[model samples]
Target: MSALSLYALFTGRKPPSVKYKYYRKYFIIYAASMSSFAVHTVFICFFYVINIPILSVINVFSVSVWALALRENYYGRHSNAIFLACAEISIHAVLATAYLGWSSGFQFYLWPAACLATINPRLGVRLSSAIGFGCIVLFILLKTVVDDGLYNFDFRKYADFFYVFNGIIAGISLIFGICSIRVINERQEEKLTDLATKDELTNLFNRRYINSYLSEYEPDADLENRPYCIVLGDLDYFKKVNDTLGHYAGDDVLIDVSRYLKQRFRSSDVVCRWGGEEFLFLLKDTSLRQAHDLVEKICRDIPDNIHVCSSQRIRITMSFGIAASTGVSQHEQLIKVADENLYQAKKQGRNCVVSSEITG
Candidate 1:
């Protein structure tokens, strides 16, 4: 399996994953630093065998990055931690290349730094690009100006081995970092989708989703005469609750009513918080009689009182109007028809269900 796929599988699907941008970035950088610490510790053993003291010093710098990651995590200053990590990696790359000669393959470290700086949305593209350019310039200058006398070990003797090793590590780091970016992007997309489709107050499907669903949903005409029904529901005396107990209590009532309505409807049914103190449902593959029966069941099942703040129990009721599309192609007309039935229900008396086919 590819490194990205393996890493994803190893991590598994963590639902409702870390959503905070700063915290997510912090986690990625912390993980990178920890991995660096492990890799550098392994290199420390290799350097000890070769008696390369400067390379040992570079490994110490990697340890320092780990320490800084811990400190930044403690302080909850995650952005600074990422910046410091990028700087740490860059400096280690420059110094290692300068002291051990470019053949030590230290220049490969710059790729991860560039990847981190580029992918992190918090960091500016132009600024990271400039930093990457500087690293490239620094590497070239080190190769040009640094003499062989400064080098402790001649890595050129095992250049192919060192090159392959460095390439594998660099490739792994780049792949892991890119996968992390993709994970964050996916989380953000999920979050945005929720915000766009969900009602802020009731946490039910909002008017936007309902409107979109109505426009897109096409049922098979051969199944039945009327394949769907739209039920319009409004809380009876909702304004009185708001005026008497305050809007907060009214909000509580709406949320409670939403829960009750959700339980009454089937999973295939589309239930939405249509507006303030109002809800809408689209019952799929339901006849007008079935729709009316479902709406009546909901009206009867909904509790008469909702307990809100300060243990104050407030009484409320809902009025329902249901209309089914009878061989009619237009869904918009069903909504209008349902709304009119709802008005008729209120006119007759609140806390009742009205349907054009059943009531009229």
Candidate 2:
């Protein structure tokens, strides 16, 4: 519907899609209503009563064309838009039918033109309606009132009412579009802010963000089991791949590693980029053993895909250290113990998980 509105507003220009759907049907119906008013009203003075046979044919044809456009506009359809469109169509259909009876459907087409005001909360709808309504009024005066050359339009006596009606339509489109644009812009900003805190390379929370969040997280000292476990893992000899293949290949390694962690861990587990060549996982509501074992599984599963250096299948491994939040006063305290264990894992042999609980 937005696309249709955008196109109509731009006089048949194409619009970009955040997502695509057909509200074009509604827009086309709207345009048809306005355009039809122009066509139908021109003849109202001659007949004073619409040709029902012709109107029936035109209405039926209009409905069919709208259905086709409706289907296409549905590519990005929302239920709300559908409901609104249906309501607008129903109202316009009834009014159009009545206009046919009075042979003045064109004169009243302004009513349906005003319906565009409801298309959105933007001021544009109301503005368009006003423009259209003004056109209708001018159409009425030029053809009917000025006929005797006395500058006497029949509706000139009630021009105030018509002007007010146009003003209302203008206000409606403007408010709706403004509100909708503001909300859409706000959402886009929020998504952008969220992206800023993420690691584009690994699709994980960046270490800076993790640290900031951790700094804000208050620990519970009285709990028997820890609230969470922090695991630090470093890829063993990661520099060798970069040194051999290139930075691009090294990026793939990081991506694969991140995916491996995400696949194995629960949704609640948070994986973060813990500086270059290292990663961190915060497992919520986990014990020391569970944390250590989980990290061990992740360390073991790092894919050594053939794409590493020579486009040949290769294996990759990392060493992990685990520490529970239990008895840890600060976020760094937990990381400190985890780092110690990680160093121990590296010393024992690469590609293993080391835990202080197991060492002593």
Candidate 3:
């Protein structure tokens, strides 16, 4: 199966949307709970075989504690569930080390508890750090106070095996917790980048992102220094639409225009909303005549009936000004020339295309 499918199976579903604040926490806690349940179930059998009645009974209770934590997390009582898990792991580690001795390596489970304390966001950094430090102190106490096994059993001869087993499980738990934190951080970074670069309403490139693109753009040297064109477009009488029909209707009109522009342009071309009622388009590898023709066709083919609401439809038109990279290399120069042409189009009439080479 693919990695994405595996991730879905592990998390019990596809990743939740970024808007959900607690999704990452929920996933981490749920996975921990299930893993704890399975691990304790193994301990229950191991203790029974070794004839350690007290430890076996304790592990049976540990399995039930993990089950209860899982149910609490499912119901969104995340703080309570996390507390239960931390308390159980800490207690179990101390008890196991006291009985079997530190050579058995049960105290290593305390390290994962330290890591988890720091990961949980609801626990402030100071408190989490303190808890982590407490785990270290507890580990020292286990080493100094419990020098050897208390129970005289035949299984005590296999201390090395038990040590290796507990160490591996604790290491796996630590790796899992760290990987969960990494996934959450990467997802949050993606969400922040999208918010910075995209217009929320139009879902198109915003003015700031478009300017950055233009500033960094370079023409292909192998293509004989092919030129690009910039088109400045303004919706005619857009303010009048807002004055007559509410701002909501005006927003619907902008959304419709944005959708049309996105569909009409080539994938290589850049389309952006340059503030209220104005748009900017960058047509790569196009000449003056080609850019003019394209804009004229777009103006002619615009849909007349734009639906703003269930009962309302309106007709709208736009004016476009095109500037080709004939003598200029800088984006600022091209934009200034396009803006000047846009002014001329507004002066002559609305709903027309004006370029350096032709006017229509």
Write the number of the candidate with greater lDDT, choosing between 1 and 2. Answer: 1
TM-score of 1: 0.76
Instruction: State the lDDT of candidate 3 residue by residue for 1-360, as single tens digits.
Output: 467744653464524322258767777787889888888999899888888878898898899899888766766677778877887888899888888898889899899888777666678899998998898899999999995857636567778998998999899988987887798899899889889998888888999998989886744421356678899999988887888798998898899999998889999999999889999999988889999999999988775534455444455888999888753366777788888899888988978888883221
Give the Å shift of residue 324 in candidate 2.
0.8
Q: How many angstroms is residue 234 displaced in model 1 relative to the true structure, after the best TM-score fit?
A: 1.0
RMSD from true fold, candidate 3:
6.6
Which stretch of 10 consecutive residues in model 2 shows the poorest summed lDDT?
97-106
Top-lDDT structure, candidate number: 3
The residue ranges of model 1 lying beyond 4 angstroms of the native Cα positions read: 1-21, 38-49, 69-77, 94-107, 130-165, 218-226, 304-314, 327-329, 357-360
**Candidate 2, number of clashes:** 37
lDDT, candidate 2, equals 0.58
Per-model tally of clashing residue pairs = 0, 37, 0
Ranking by lDDT: 3, 1, 2
* TM match of model 3 to true structure: 0.76
